[model samples]
Target: MDFYVAFNKTLNRFDLKAIDLARKTDLSMQRVSQFKDGFNVRVDTLQKLLEVMPQEAKRYMLTLVAEGETDSPPSTGG
Candidate 1:
């Protein structure tokens, strides 16, 4: 999943509304809305908000960042 899907999944699980996330993460409501809705999100804006995400969410994000270089999943079948 990309940033948009990731953000929405976390928000849904946390029962967080866009407005709540905007304030908590110090992001503009428009930015958060755009991301959650699958719009193009700026790297700087995303990075700043990511700084304040929950530990679990941030961990998930770290995994994504670390794996960004690999585009395909490993083959499983012999």
Candidate 2:
């Protein structure tokens, strides 16, 4: 899944709003909206966003990023 798709999924799962996330992450609403709209953000900004998410959501987003980095399916160990 695309980063934006994962991000939106996380937002939906948490019932979070961009304005609320901006306040929690200390990011501008514009930046958050741009990210939600699929624009790439700086790594530091992405880190800030992740920091405000719940652990489960953060892990899910990171897993997607890791999978994208490897360009392979995630291992499913028996």
Clashes of each: 0, 0
- Measured with C-alpha atoms, the lDDT of residue 41 in candidate 1 is 81
Could you say which candidate leads in lDDT? 2
Candidate 1: tens digits of C-alpha lDDT, residues 7-70: 6766665565778767877788988888878899888877777776777876665555455422
Q: How far in Å is the alpha carbon of 44 misplaced in model 1? A: 1.0
Distance (Å) between predicted and true CA of 42, model 1? 0.9
- Candidate 2 lands at a TM-score of 0.76
lDDT of 2 by residue, 6-61 (tens): 78877886687778879998899999999999999998998888888889888877
Model 2 residue 65 CA deviation (Å) reads 3.5
Provide the lowest-lDDT 10-residue window in model 2: 64-73
User: Could you tell me which 10 consecutive residues in candidate 1 have the lowest summed lDDT?
Assistant: 66-75
lDDT of 1 at 33: 81
Candidate 1 stretches with Cα past 4 Å from truth are 61-77
List per-prediction Cα lDDT, in the order shown: 0.70, 0.80
